[model samples]
Target: MALTGAASAPPRLAPGGVVTRADALLAALRAAAPDPARLPRDAGALLGERAALAGLRRNGRIAAGGRARLLCAADGWIAVQLARPDDVALLPAWLEVDPARFEGDPWPALAAAVRDRAAVPLVARARWMGLPAAAAGGGSAEGGAPGMDAKPPLAEARRAGDAPPSAAEARPADGAPPRVEAPPALRVTQAGTPRRRHAGPWRVLDLSSLWAGPLATHLLAGLGARVAKVESTARPDGARRGPAAFFDLLQAGKESVALDFRAPAGREQLRRLVAWADLVVESARPRALAQLGLDAEALLAEHPGLSWLSITGYGRPEPGGGWVAFGDDAAVAGGLVARDDDGAPLFCGDAIADPLAGLHAAWAALGALRAGGGRLLDVSLAGVAAEAAAGGVDPRACVVADAGGARVLCAGRSARVAEPRARRPAGRARDLGADTTALLREARA
Candidate 1:
């Protein structure tokens, strides 16, 4: 693997094909096992997992629509998500338009507002106002036309003059890039000694939502683990609100249980469920579920073989410590966005971070299980996205449009992201709480 953005060098990106981080993960998994090839390349197979579930991939590739499209600004470009009802409701304030009158697509009205504004300030305002928006750039705060096929000054300049700095001297002003030790991604503690537990059929308690955590457990389900997905009734998994098939796409086969932990009975039920599991997966922020009394430390203390997988945006520390993030924003934070000719960034794939983290999380979980499941694996969405982007597997093609004389914009074209060529496994997405009765019975039993 090539180290990108070397001293005085640009990150060398390969021409697009399948977007896969499987090699690194497979190699890592192999380090923990004698045979790793038995692990299904779901990362490769489940490439279009979302689209295939939504029946969107049957036609070909399809970009997001409505408020999800990339829009322009006077200075550069930004992606704004007004897909939520609340998000759409706030459009009147952002664009100074009447939300009541605004129907149909909201992009045009928002675009009208962004027409003459710089992206950074607008994106800042959007964030301040609690909207999902990200500015387009090659992960740069200072936006400028990108140097065609050349390294940026940060990579090219050594000190004041002379040649580019050596890798050691190329450290940023903040010293070496931080190693992300604040809240920590993965933490392990010995619970006595590694118990030589015989492995047979396994049970999993999936307390995760959206893509990453669910994907991990889903892969585990395929590997002979009986997974019971637990969601809170007060705050159900949002994926349930998405296209029915899409929700099922990633969550099929797992038993589903929804409970309100506020209730004493509900809390007891959750405790029993946790005790019944060989593994647990969740995407909650640090101390989130612990606030609800499901302290992972205490649970692991009780069941040393129970592995806890905790997923987050950044790690659990400052910056993105407690801050919320979805796949796209987190991917952008990890510098996975496609850079246009002027270095303006574009959204790459279908929330690219989710699946990559999913793949890595599953691999990590299995590796931990083999080594003795007595740890909390901190899976950061941004870190996983950075890992995937760093693989240099992002092959981009220029999206061309037939204009008057075949004209193009700064990027000279839009970005066409590549999906890994793999067949999706056969399954059906389940309805919310569909398996509640049987799972609850099994837990009680």
Candidate 2:
């Protein structure tokens, strides 16, 4: 009954002309499910990239609009994310200028500074400081150098005090090379022995944020998993600051555990909680998790049946892991960006990567869970976007129109999708730290 009455309803969004491949995605999930009946029939009902984005907007959109956008640097374009207050505070360091120079808004000064600087060094430095910044048009940030086909994984997050892997020594091991030099659409790696457990209740630790990861955990909740959303007191999920309804829509049935992730006690609690989990859902790059001592390999080895799903903007474990990206940029990375008549890229429907990745992650998790354990699913947003795009919009499902020299596509009959109701169990959502004490005791016990 984890999610029986937990899900109320998603706000109705006027169909955006842009169509989502929701049907294809859902079909793929259903096909992959080892036990289809274990999944809610309406799994696709609450899905749609645009609908998810609409849930996050304020009045009409985010008050902090353009917090993550492509900025014009002196030599090229760079994507900088100033989503959190800490990120805002790091701008002065990123720009190497006075924080008060912008008065209150950092946009103008940031624009000027970025305009006067080159993208590469600015991106590298921003990442070195643990701030979200990346080069646009396939430029590299922390993980790999510019123009590389795949992002190489960094052994550790290249924060201000950390060291990045040396280019000379970061070579593929001697023997057979990777199957693909470029990121693969889907990659599944597992270790240890598989042990299947069919039970009435399962435990999941959700360490991801934003749409995709949250949506995956949400689906698991509907599937009868007892999901505990693990957040850091220092930086809770950004969704909390967005409209409440949207937050509730995806998080209604999950418990919240806000711990000081960096502190000794918090870290101890995290270890216990993770050890107690049947599955761990996270969207961090491998290095980020390494920094927190949650080594996937070690964890899988320690807990033979533990299934860990690592979500990234690109693939993980090397050549793609360390790279930086977000939902929109990852979709663009996947080549779904709308283009003008001149073939210039235009923004597509609401951060499409988020929802697509979410669905894919949920399906992957279910498969891993069904397989029993010792499964590590590395899901990349860009890779998923590429996977969805590889299917392409069915020509029969769309129509093209030309406007002022710009070409656009509109959804047709094939795009008219529906969300049918299912008998999901009733459940409740918890507030920040609502179950910390009880969970800590359980973990310890």
Candidate 3:
């Protein structure tokens, strides 16, 4: 929501929580819908339809700038002109959310929501629904809705085709505030400028697949670290062939190398990389890394200062029975996702939970690397989901309007998946706090 420096991070929801953009867009669409309560039960399905509706309304007036028209709806749904019927047909899947979680200080509550939601997985059903601004309306060429664009200044930073401006150009002259395009998919900053070489034993091996693991390495690469992205031909990263925007966006500023770790040579290459690397990031489930014979303990044995970052759908085993299964995005919605009582999931509409955790993992790796300890990070998507929702999944907390013409309310201001009061027996109390006590007593009487 606030931008201080030249680089402004996008809003991030707790690991399983909705990205701010997704929330903003969904809220706008809900507010504008003929009947806000008629959205679909599934968040993904509703978003698909809403995007389709926006396309139909525009009717081919779609332009590089037309995306801004969508954001303007945040103030109130307004008429959006499309350039062509095809443009209108294209539905936006990306939903904007609160930016503070991503750029500013990390909110533990949001992070927890992301963790809890990782148990349920969802397919990447749509491309990022970008709302580029309309130039004619005094909006920059950056991809943002009129007033509610993701990062209006960041949108202004790019020249064309989504490339970031040169480092020199990124900084504004005359002491004026720097103008940026949408928050960059890749933010590359060396620890120090070229003239001042950064101090360290530096090497990072990225043995990760999908957006989470690889994205972490990509962030490091942008920051002047040489990242070796190792993917086996047998188990390639899914994003290698994802949407054009995503693939280009995710893979930028990095080197791509393939290796089949199952093979003897692959294992040898991996070891060599590990021996040379200061850090390694993997997205496989717990102990899955050991199958590849890349256990954290063994890695530390080989490289005393190796930072092993492991990302999983769920948390590492704890004393309690908190073990849960999580998928990419869908799981988060199913678990911690905001929904209405009628049973409609409020889709965050972005691959938010996974990536935010990845970013945090990168930060953790950096921290461990700085501390000079061979660190082991278990990034739990489910934990992140729970953190996002502030430690609970209450269906009555907020009303989410969807495309299918439905509205779902999560009960109470706070609801914990670990203990759902709504499921308790009538005239009985589960975990009702003081506020809920009176209501429960009144209902019982």
Candidate 4:
């Protein structure tokens, strides 16, 4: 598929070239979809929807959503995100400072503490403590070189652990010394089987929260999939706590099944739900699912027709698998930041990586389904961001300012920054666990 839109079309919908890449993916998705009309006409608009709903703006140093910041360390720059209270509580430990030193707002203290520290070590400490942080321009596309703009694969599909690693998977894309620690951008883990076309709408079990995974299934739902979203009663989708309208936009049209995985009955209900699904979309870390006895590899082995989409901050491999990351920091990890006139990196948009990954994940899932279903698709926020960055317009040339305000320029054209627009919620999103009783009863039957 083509990686970009036509030159006559607006190559960018926002400051960076992400919208351009998103447009390309959306075109491919529309072409491949059974119902092309179900997808949005301009996927670029989806990139800014979160920001528009939240009234977020592009701050050169602050993330569009205002939850993350780009700060200068002694050696280089780094991005840090404290989107949750739990993340804030760990700041003292991450910075090795006394908790008493921080009070009302933490940014001032954080900036002071990080200013004299080296970026790499601080990022390392933050990741070790589960805080989302990354050094600016540190990512390597396909394990090329740190900060190189080469394109990386959107998803890495590999055969489960039962199969041996292929030679291509064992080496870096650049033919450098072997670094098996890094996963390849994309690989065909399992050979494609004859297409196993579904007789009816595909049944999708979505066990993911937040933007990327839900957006993937939401797109699928738009394309006539029967989607059931499984949540935990104890800890439901955190999005439920945010703007209800925003939550509704992503969760609309999907039946809700809330289960407490801690309970034996709930676990069994989850397994039964999995059995009922033709495809599964989840964003949990590998270990989190393994603890629940719903390991993807084993499940794929057990169900020959199953297709699994695993979305994470990084690919499911050592080093990356264990690390913690969020959208802003993951984008930074992928070197997907826009550059200011002085060459300093700035966040391109609101959780840019999440939407990009969401688009790629949905497209990959559909491709897997078309190829007859026994596939494990591994998509990472950082990897997708890198791919967009590699294929994106030059950061320096993307934004220009006039008295009218900042405008994005691409492919010899200029356009005003587009506001995020939401499609009317497909339908009102069902309340959390609203379908639990009926779903569980059906499973029992």
Highest lDDT scorer: 4
Worst 10 residues of 4 by lDDT: 1-10
Model 2 clashes, total count? 12
- Per-candidate TM equals 0.67, 0.70, 0.44, 0.83
TM-score of 2: 0.70
Model 2, residue 432: C-alpha shift (Å): 2.4
Q: Which stretches of candidate 1 lie over 4 Å from their true place?
A: 1-20, 23-45, 55-78, 89-105, 109-131, 135-199, 241-246, 287-291, 391-425, 429-431, 434-438, 441-445
Regarding TM-score, does 1 or 2 come out ahead?
A: 2
Top-down lDDT ranking: 4, 2, 1, 3
Per-residue lDDT for 126-145 in model 1, tens only?
Answer: 54345666544433322121
Clash counts per candidate, in order, are: 6, 12, 94, 1
Candidates' C-alpha lDDT: 0.56, 0.60, 0.38, 0.70
Clashes of 3: 94
On lDDT, the stronger of 2 and 3 is 2
On TM-score, the leading prediction is: 4
Residue range 346-429, candidate 3, lDDT tens digits: 223233345455555666665666566456666765444434433333223332334442233443343221100111111211
Sort order, TM-score high to low: 4, 2, 1, 3
